[model samples]
Target: MSTSMAENATKKLTLKSGDDELFEVEETVALQSQTIKHMIDEQWLGDVIPLPNVTGKILSKVIEYCRRHAGAGAGSGDASTSKSEDELVLATTTSGDDLKAFDADFVKVDRCTLFDLILAAHYLNIRTLMDLTFQTAADMMKKLTVEEVRTMFNIENDFTKEEEEKIQQEHPSAFK
Candidate 1:
């Protein structure tokens, strides 16, 4: 490769997940996470950025989200300049619809994966990912019984009978 070509190449960062999986992500993409941005700013440019709280599967999904949004300038406010006029027009017209569809398909995972995504998003401090995962979880809980919600999340009922009765009385519509 030419010297200028190599010089202009996007810099990459290696992220190590809890499961010992390493992912190569562009600096622009990884900087979407405030936690990662701070780490980089503080000279945390070691061999690999250790993400001890994120599993390989969830980290992969998070990287996928970051790559998509980074490419589209979702959080950074810098759109791509390489698109043709027709392509740009198409993206302008359908970007929102396309993103909505992508998000809907992205969150259609099992409960465990959903929770893993929520935890990973929170840890990474990626607001868009956090909001999307939280809203998805909330949508899953809508109109469900308390028992069903607990069962779905594998959460044991820790409230005493009195406490449960008081809560039910306070939020009668929720119970009903």
Candidate 2:
């Protein structure tokens, strides 16, 4: 097909990586990102826009988040007005039990995937997702002991015994 025709015909995109892995996403969803929008505007993307920084797995998950939010008209700059997230919460207040269940389940993800979701949400500029992910992370920090936190993330304790004790004293509530 001619280049102009190809450009016009493309409403979806296949983002490929150097390893030849591909991710399929809608133009509207992909364009939630300013980076992707610029690529579309400049017609720099062919059938497959290469995203070498993103692995196929992470990109796939990101695409899932983007697609869902996009379909709900949650992304930025659409002509149609969206209910503010607070307004959405208010409207759903009558169904409080259901919302609580959904929120609980939404955060039930592996630690690595939780961080991945946080990064993806931030990159796509999805505020609700980021807030949820960050809150989950903070909850983990609050609940886990210092040793437990170190074990969970495989982080080494750098402090000497005396230093560790001093820190514990300084932040007495952290250990409790």
Candidate 3:
């Protein structure tokens, strides 16, 4: 690689969150989000790239996630691998236990923060972060009852008693 290319790869980009907090991150780290990469590619948006959908708190967490993953050598440029799913799994399991542990600890925040992370990950188009946050939420929901799940997400029950009974009767197995 050329010296200029290496310098460009390490160039820092300023990210401005919705709450107007600014963060400076490396080019490779910021490129983990396809949204930011698209913005940089289409137009160099001056000194700061604005992310209106993500708050400062959530944006910080997202930057932490990106930096850790990028430092672990994960990147969006490795789409040409010939390894199968099983092979990849085996490789990661054998060599990436520390990264796995880091991911586990990263998602151990409260439900509200987890949800915020999910929203930020989705809006930024960070696929791996989305998967991690989603899987964490799914794991939290497992073994919970319908009412418990609804309550956890602050969803209200809108069905009348008779409607609920009839639906349950029609799909008893689902209710179980």
Top candidate by TM-score: 3
**Model 2, span 1-176: residue lDDT tens:** 45544443345677784467987665656776665677778978477787665566767766655554454553235322333333233344425464456556766888988887777667656666677789999998898888898998899998999998998899998788
lDDT of 3 by residue, 48-150 (tens): 9999999999999999888767655532245214233333343454437777998999999998999999999999999999999999999888768779988
- Once fitted onto the true fold, the runs of candidate 1 whose alpha carbons sit more than 4 angstroms away are 1-9, 74-94, 153-170
As for lDDT, the candidate ahead, 1 or 2, is 1
Where is model 2 more than 4 Å wrong at Cα? 1-10, 17-19, 41-43, 74-78, 81-106, 121-128
Question: What TM-score does candidate 1 reach?
Answer: 0.80
Tens digit per residue, CA lDDT, model 1, 78-174: 3434332333444455466677888889999998899999999999999999999999999889868989988887899999999999999999989
Q: Give the Cα error of residue 110 in candidate 1, in Å.
A: 0.4
Which pairs, if any, clash in model 3?
none
Model 2 Cα shift for residue 111 (angstroms) = 1.7
Q: Write down the RMSD of all candidates, one decimal each.
A: 4.4, 7.0, 6.0
TM per prediction: 0.80, 0.66, 0.81
Pick the lDDT winner: 3
Error of 3 at 155 (Å): 2.2
